[model samples]
Target chain A: MNRLTALVIAFALLLFAPARALDIQLTSGDWQPINIFVELFLGEENLNGQIPSDIIADDLTVSGNFRAYKENQNHANAMSAERLGDIRNRGGEYLITGTVNNKSGKQYTLSFTLYDTLTNDKIGSYSIVFNNENQRLVAHNVSNWIYETILSKAGIFHTKVAYVVRHEDGTNELKVADYDGHNRLVMLTSQDHIISPTWTANGNSLLYVSFEQNKPVIYQQSLLTGERSIVANFKGSNSAPAASPDNRTIAAALTEHGGLQQIYLLSGNRKARLRESKGIDTEPVFSPDSKHLAFISDESGSPQIYQFNLDDNKTRRLTFGSRYNVSPDYSAQGDVLTLVRRDENGDNISILDIRNGDTIPLTNTASTNSPSFAPNGDVISFIDDRNKKNLATVSVNGKVIVFWRDSEQGEIINPSWSPIKSDWF
Target chain B: MKKQNFASLATIFFALVLTGCAASKGAYSGNIEDDRSGEAGLAPVSAGTAGKASSPGFVKSSTIDDERTSTDSLLQKRIIYFDYDKSAVRDEALPILHTHAEFLNNKGGAIGIVLGGHADNRGSNEYNLALGQRRANAVRDIFLSYGASANDIEAISFGEEQPRAQGDNESAWQENRRVEIRYTDE
Candidate 1:
């Protein structure tokens, strides 16, 4: 009789398994970043021993939740038992070790493993192949996989940040780089300025505003093929381009020949303008759910952040404290919007909670704008002019902030992080 | 003695009022001119080559002629100042508007000007662009009222992107919040 009942329950579960799969939630929970330690790899010939380990350490540190420490010795492979004792003695909960082999030409292979020293077991092991040019990226992939295995969360190691850099010649160039600001590639350079770049959902294309045609025109550039086409070139001015989370719609701020700047939604050739007062409406960033748009409007008086609802065609004010709250960007969870708030001193970064309408100050440093969330929503990348206009990232919940700069490259501004797709990992 | 003193004081006050020598013209409103030394100057009540320090030769060529120096001096004033967060045309901007309007009307359709409006870096870039455009439109409206055809001028706003002065102080902000009357490069 016990066996018969167990068989019946198993059959019911098998029948309802599709429903369970359908109801699986894609959301992750609020958790704190953990500290992890990475041991140096054994092989130094492929690209030198420390390059891959340093890249992994940098990626982990930038993730906001992890503080990675390097052991100085490459002894995790041969003496696993002794190394485990050493890591435990050093107060490390987890240890990462890897080996590299140089193959023909630019081809190389990495065999990295993450160990749970507390449990005395291997948590993750990856065998990845990359050319010499992408060896560092392969190490980042190893870091991300370890993060996924440990935290049950998607890692941002493979993500890239797109931003605009102003050259000394007064020209602007769009470039993409590793999340840690390593291995940058310039996409387009123009005689005029480019501002407000947004990555599409698929991460294959980017929407940006360029003044190359002597006007603020929005263009969609394919990152793979380098083909460019104007998405929004109105009669007067077009700028502040952003893509919806669903990737089915595009939103941007546009002005006609003699009109006020207003937010408009586009789906192919069909377009509809959202209702806004005579206020100067611009910089419409779509919420992750695509239900509301957060934009900067000066309708009530000075420029303040306001949200527009697509369902009801109504706009509500989000910020009331600062008179100058602009350049807003919504977080990945759609619960917070980071924007620039101006006080008597200078512009500072501030975060606004959508639930209670309460705001918290992010940075006391002046001369910062365009605060964008990291793909994981655990970090934010903003343009920091505190030290000559470099790309800066800050942990969302922590005080750990890092700045990436190339002095030869002029002022860097307006950084946009790619979104994390369900299948990204 | 008290009555005599009262009568004498009234006489002195009335004489001073009638003679128009009580207060200087620029004591209160002239502080902004000092803040705008390197910028294009506004037309002044008195003509002593007031705005020549910054006005380009293109603006001074026709206005510096000897015959119409009075009106030409007004035309030399090319910068229009706006109140903070307010794009409406103010009374102080009227004289400069009249100067540019007269310049446009008298120059026929031969001269075209682009009214590029700008704002300080206190607001969002695109909203500032619209506010700057509102200012440009305000100038354009006043110019149209003064007999300049619509085609003679185009209104554009660079917003806060191209600031005339780069600083965090009030003086720099005052100089940056303006609408410049630029002659078309053509």
Candidate 2:
């Protein structure tokens, strides 16, 4: 092309580029959650068929990437092209059709087929043979498999979330539930208060701080046995225990020596100080790589989030925009840090991009704090007390907010989402 | 008619009760301006004036003098509120803390008191616990300077776990950030 024509084309492209960008921004985002319809199971002789369907529906809906609903039909054959056309006509993007059949001798077969309504493509089909007791677990595994197959992302349906709930009588209990806040089982209950429940790297154990003995002591509880062992019983306070990803050491705030709270790495009976100051330092969380620690400190006149390095022991402030920022935890990738920020209005949870130090507010509610990220880094669970103290999960992109409202007088305060069950599931 | 009759009946009953329970010649519920602080402590003793042993050289009744004792209600006003994220003693709470310090001093360290510190649910629980401890320590330091012994003081912090107020507003939060003085004997 000649120079004049090329220059004209370049100018036109520049002029149209911004307009296209604006149009893309204005339209319904392509990431808009897919509408999912889960069909009921057809073959079930020994167990209820709808249980598997509900599990899949809940798994997809809670992921924040899909909107799920139960379909009217109960046949696996309903996922054919003709049936899928009707689903697409009804604004369904994905169709999940399945069947649950009793094979014999307390064994059952559960299967599901995923279909793309728009393209009429059979994405994948999965099946599992599970014992009677593991019926619910089989459903969860199938949901995760369907999620990973369709969304190209790992699913957290099989994960567990442990949180401390304060009852009306001023007692506290450490409770664990499925990702959707279902199948809840109390792990520990104390007449005193308990705060900050975090999962160990194995995902089968928990590390939490409890005031069961009238003093704060960090304890480790096994999910399998319901037994707890004292992890840290320091003099002043032992609180905010964050288990390292390697499971070798725990970084917690201790006032054992000098009567001032500071971050320390506790392995067995030995502790190496991570950070020291006259000011208060607590809620120490490890980075995803376990190379650094971020905790709350008031050395700069107000409580703020600070990061201390492991290699050089250099301490640096990570939050500056807000006067009050605390209760910090990291994403699975360690690129984003979620913390509570306070302004004139009230306290709200926000995410800080560690790479650029850009903080983004995640919730507009008055008091939301103690955010812990899902293992996939897609959502962060925090506590807010607007109506009452309850556990809430917010999508990383700030699009979805799911409050675990099903709890009975649930005054859930401190929450930590368990890591991905990749080692088992 | 029943309400009016009940009101008059309640009035007559209250008048009789107040007259019997009044520690002074004035009204039963003394105003803050009553300045009869010592007289208020007598009502809590519940022992009638006739129970005291009359000894020689005690010409005047012990309760006859202008003795003032903090009333039960006044002594129970032990909560001291501080500003947000602050541990310093407020101006309004200084006199109350002073009264406590003097009571400790006059006892000559015979009695011990525990200062329970607390903070609002604004920050992390551990930080709030630390701040609450600092507030209690601030009170402990003030009490120590006023001749209160270190042995007579035990400071503990509950942080934001226990809140006196339940809302998310500043009014509730202000009440939650406080230090309460609890005598060990009680």
lDDT string for model 1 (A304-351, tens) is 888888899788898886678888888878999888888777788888
Per-residue lDDT tens digits for candidate 2, residues B1-186, read: 332354345434433443354334332221111212233321111111222211111122334111124455345568998998788898788788888887777766545676778899866787888888789888888887778877566666778877889987899999999998866544
Instruction: Please provide TM-scores computed only on chain A for all of the candidate models, following their numbering.
Output: 0.86, 0.85
| CAPRI verdict (incorrect, acceptable, medium, high) for model 1 | incorrect
lDDT of 1 at B54: 17
- Highest DockQ among the candidates is held by which one? 2
Candidate number of the best lDDT: 2
Candidate 1 per-residue lDDT over residues B1-186, each given as its tens digit: 342354345434433442232133222121111111333322211211111121111222434343234654765677888877777877987887787677778777655676777788764566676778778777888888988887666666677766788786888888888888866432
Interface RMSD of each: 22.6, 22.0
Candidate 2 Cα outliers beyond 4 Å, as residue runs = A1-31, A35-37, A43-50, A84-94, A104-106, A116-121, A258-260, A422-425, B1-80, B91-114, B143-155, B164-174, B181-186
A-chain TM-score in candidate 2? Answer: 0.85
